[model samples]
Target chain A: MPDAGITAFADWIATTSLSHLIAQKLWAIPAIQSVHIMSLAIVFSSALVVDFRMLGLMSTGQPLSAIARRFLPGVWIALIFATISGLLLLIAEPVRSLPTWEFQGKMLSLLCVIILTLSFQKLIAARAPAWDAMPGVPAGAKLAALVSIVLWILIIFGGRWIAYHAG
Target chain B: MSITEFLQALESTAFATAVREGAILFPFAESLHVVALAFVIGTVVFVDLRLLGLASRNQPVTRLTNDLLPWTWGAFVLAAITGLSLFSSTPERYFTNTFFRWKFFFMFLAGVNMLVFHFVTQKNVKEWDNDPVPPTPARVAGALSILFWACVIVFGRWVGFTL
Candidate 1:
């Protein structure tokens, strides 16, 4: 459950003019959500490409660093767009968004995945050539890739469940 | 029977009713649809960008498309199946919705663009396989693909609102 302070903040946000504007405008929420979903498609797909490469599922002929360089920047850039749209959604309905366990879980999972992705990128930057020279991807890198994919899927579930599970 | 009657029947079927009224079934299907769509669009965009000479310029177009097409096809099948499941739940509602109809229109355009590229434009892929910039027809196809898919997503999102 949300604490008193969080509940108070949500209440205050609900009373704001922005919330009222969003509530009155039928197209606003869906428009914002469309942007959010499109950005998420870019981010998730980019991450999948890098992860698939790490797992030797595709593009095994290409160097890992080359593939990561091509796709990982898209993940970060699209994430910025998704976050901005998500914040607009939260502002529009703070009470519905802030107090939900599903929302909280989504944030936590997002944070973990971001950290995992960053560390993976850092490792690649430092040692991609050494690892790429090896006959196969290391066990640890493949494990991280699997974890990254799972966390991303979990985050997607949490996002959809928020509306259904919210108070 | 007429198309409308067939859709009405589909909506009233036991499986469709179960999906419509069940607490989790609809949302689960929607989430799966979204996941599958992300991969489909993502993989398609990657290839399109390559064709447009916007990204991954170092990699050969043939190699990139060949590697990514399998994931794209696999995810596209999942997306279509889940999309059908969602449509079955309220067949008439979706069938009559303007945005829903537009979504299919754009999807059809995207498919035609792909087919033209495969049959005509790509007949001589070897001519420009390794070039940083593909020929004009290939670039045009890539641009059309991006535009068509963008329309599909926007219209698809509007369907939920209009529904």
Candidate 2:
């Protein structure tokens, strides 16, 4: 984020009723936790389906496009929840997280994954055969998929590592 | 007593050096452990969602399980071996660690929950063979798997903090 963007976000978070809402009760914390946990299943469900298909577990006859169409919604939903709950968790400890280089690094990687997800949708689903068939997914396409999975795994590892090396 | 002595006392059968040095083996067992986790967690999420009516609208539950079962066993093996080596490194802490204990409890529940799904619910699977939605037993198993896995992850996270 730009310095201006950071300043603006901090201002909005501080000035809004969101601060008071999160502060109102302890139950809110667990609610945030539940959202975080539930989203894991959703996100994993979507990714695994596509990965399974890629690995040729199911829907082999169906084009990769159809299989991806079959599961991208859950991925989006989980990303949304993961984003919201993640933001709430970060807000709960912005003072500490803001300067934490690990947090910053994770955010950067996440940005890369999201950009890749958007930039290469057709390529990702290119296996589906519904697309212009672009001949076949380039090596670049497979690299993007692998990169996406690695990013998610790294983020999870980073999240777990945060407790140990919070700074 | 020293940490080494304490860990040795918890599981006296093995040499402390042999046990704690799991990273030394760096062999097939370690590789299997990782592959197993991918299978177990990966299939669990997919199958659980199907229980909740999430994906693969036309696929059979049996077929899905048959495809994924090998991986689950793989994960279970990795977790078991790594878990053993992991415990050997710090048995005393794990024995008394609240989070570690809860993780064990949840892991046990996950196992039993899975077993119940196989034995009690296996019969009912055919009943819902053509049905898109699984029966309540399968749904309950799915819910428990999610809850149990979540607890396991939390405990795993908390272990790093508390220990």
Most accurate candidate by lDDT: 1
Clashes of each: 0, 8
**For residues B74-134, what per-residue lDDT tens digits would candidate 2 score against the true structure?**
6577778766665665577777899888988998999999889888887768888656888
TM-score of each: 0.95, 0.71
Candidate 2 lDDT at A61 equals 51
Question: All candidates' lDDT scores?
Answer: 0.90, 0.64
> For candidate 1, what is the lDDT?
0.90
Give fnat (model 2): 0.07
Give each candidate's interface RMSD in Å: 1.0, 6.4
Model 2 lDDT, residue B141, Cα: 90
Candidate 1 stretches greater than 4 Å from native: A134-136
For candidate 2, lDDT tens digit of each residue in A80-153?
98889988876764544554556677788778866766565556544344432333345656566677777766
Q: Compute DockQ for each candidate against the true complex.
A: 0.76, 0.19
Summarize candidate 1's per-residue lDDT along A1-167 as a digit string, tens digits: 64788879989998999888986798888888888888999999999999998898878877888888999999999999999999989989898878788888999999999999999899988888786665346898899999999999989988888878834
Which CAPRI level is candidate 2?
incorrect
List chain A TM-scores, every candidate, in order: 0.94, 0.72
